[model samples]
Target: MIFFRSLLVAMLVILSAYTAVVVGNHGMNLLTVFFADMAAIEWPGQFNLDFMFMLALSALWVLWRQGISLSGIGLALCAFFGGALFLSCYLLVLSVQTNGDVRKMLLGRHMPAHS
Candidate 1:
């Protein structure tokens, strides 16, 4: 069980990292397309906050069920590096779309100007 859980966490980290890269490189349109496909299968409505919430919940379940401590091997690396990488890219897109200043605050010197 522990091994399985660790494997699951690793897979999630990889998938999230891949998604972050794709979203950063190709843009949210690609994510929207992926979400659309997901919706077609399980969700009938347009992809929105609800779908995102569900995904987050599902991730939480995996994290919890794995029984790995927050300081454990998988969680530490994923939360520190992989999760940060994924969230940074996602927030960047959100900042671009909404012109939100919070992104600048979070990214500090790393953000590109709106020019």
Candidate 2:
């Protein structure tokens, strides 16, 4: 479990770094290209719609897991705007905090093991 989580952390870190460099080279107008694709008549538009759904879902899940308070809103915004960057970092830290107990790390609640 720890090994897999460590692998994911490494992968996300590399991907994030690469993406940052690419974005830096391209500039913020890259996001305009990103947004422009949403109007396409094929897979790109579909993918963007799917991503938007998942984006909203992630924000809602963040709110659900955290709460309806200030911190909850803050986390939801992070989950909304940060996307996988926030999720990967959040999960890595959460897994560490929960000692790699996947259920507690993911579900935010503990369950009794059946005998």
Candidate 3:
């Protein structure tokens, strides 16, 4: 169960990063786009923030509970992976709303024609 949870977290991070890149390529501010996209779908923006905060807090709590010292690498990974996860989920949701089937099959799938 823990392994699956970790795997899910990793996948979410990758998806979030991909979403951010796609949005950025389309001239959107990653953060604003993420929040707006979530809002449009009736998802609270706080969900993403809260999730990250909880994950970090849980990691810290575990370390403390185990009497383990936190390392810089662990902190870095938490931030990096956590950010990617949040962004990916945000972007994935936004992409679904913005690029429906028609858009995905046509405009989104093709390169823009040069003037």
Candidate 4:
């Protein structure tokens, strides 16, 4: 659990720094460049498409974890667009909420604890 927490924090830090650098250099026109690469039929485009699918999968997982509530749908959207930025933060919060329980973190607290 500690290892997982450390890894999540590290990923969040690294991604945040890298994204800052990228946005600074490229401005906020991510959608245009992302789609343009796909339209050009290049390697970057291929990678982007693969990554997009992964994001979709992440969103689906988040929705399922939340039982597909209205709030879950909102979170799913954030998971899709915010990517790792959203997920890293989300997991960190879940870690705290679940008290480092890996099973609960992954599956959520769907059932009441047996007394």
Candidate 5:
């Protein structure tokens, strides 16, 4: 559990720093570049497409785990746009809340811990 927490913190810090640098250099034109690569039939575009689906899946999981309520919908949006930035922080907080219960962390607070 400690290891997981540490890893999540590290991921959060690294990704946040990297994202800052990227935004600093690129000036927030991610969507244009992201789609342009795909439109041009490039490997980056393929990877972006794959990554986009993965983000969607992450958002879906967040919604499912939250029982699809209004808050769940908001969280799903964050999960979609925020990517690992949202997830690492979410899991980090959940780890503390659940006292290192891996199943609970993945399954949600309302679920039985063991099931």
Candidate 6:
């Protein structure tokens, strides 16, 4: 699990670079194009919506992970803006953190002990 940690980090770097390039080129019009496509009736449009919903869920998961703390809120915002990049990096960190404890990584720190 930890072996792919660097891969995840690579993905994060790629995503960040992609975002910088896109936003640098398109600016806020990127958002306008995004929403315009959101309203389209096509498979790609639907796929984009589905992907965005997953991103929202990712942000929610970050919020859940952080709880109501300030840092948690900050991370949730990061997840919102960062999408798969943030999520992949988070899981990578978690995988390294818990050793072999998959449950802890996926289910959060408060995962109940098996009785």
User: Which candidate number would show the highest TM-score if scored against the true structure?
Assistant: 5
lDDT by residue (1-115, candidate 5, tens digit) is 8888999999999999999999999889999999999898889999999999999999998998887789999999999999999999988988998899887877884687457
Q: Write the per-residue lDDT of candidate 2 for residues 15-100, one digit (tens) a residue.
A: 79988898899866755675678866578877877887898899888787776889989989998887888888888888888788
- The stretch of ten residues in a row with the least summed lDDT in candidate 2 is 106-115
What total of clashing residue pairs does each candidate reach? 0, 0, 4, 0, 0, 0
lDDT of 4 by residue, 1-115 (tens): 8898899999999999999999999999999999999999999999999999999999999998988789999999999999999999999999999898777888874644661
Q: Itemize residue pairs with steric clashes in candidate 5.
A: none
lDDT of 3 by residue, 6-95 (tens): 555678867767877887787656567656756775556667667557667644543333244455336444544555564334335434
Global fold similarity of model 5 (TM-score): 0.93
Per-residue lDDT tens digits for candidate 6, residues 4-43, read 7777888888888988898898785755676677788677
Compute each candidate's TM-score over C-alphas: 0.29, 0.81, 0.31, 0.91, 0.93, 0.75
Q: Kindly report which residue stretches of model 2 are placed more than 4 angstroms away from their true locations once superposed.
A: 109-115
lDDT of 6: 0.78
lDDT of 1 by residue, 30-54 (tens): 5567567766765544454465565
**Superposition error at 18 for model 5 (Å):** 0.7
Please list all clashing residue pairs in model 1, or write none if there are none.
Answer: none
Between candidates 3 and 6, which one is better according to lDDT? 6
On lDDT, who's better, 3 or 4? 4
Give the TM-score ranking, best first. 5, 4, 2, 6, 3, 1
Each prediction's whole-model lDDT (CA)? 0.52, 0.78, 0.51, 0.92, 0.91, 0.78
Candidates in descending lDDT order: 4, 5, 2, 6, 1, 3
Deviation (Å) of 57 in candidate 2:
1.6
Off by over 4 Å in 4: 109-115
Worst 10 residues of 1 by lDDT: 75-84
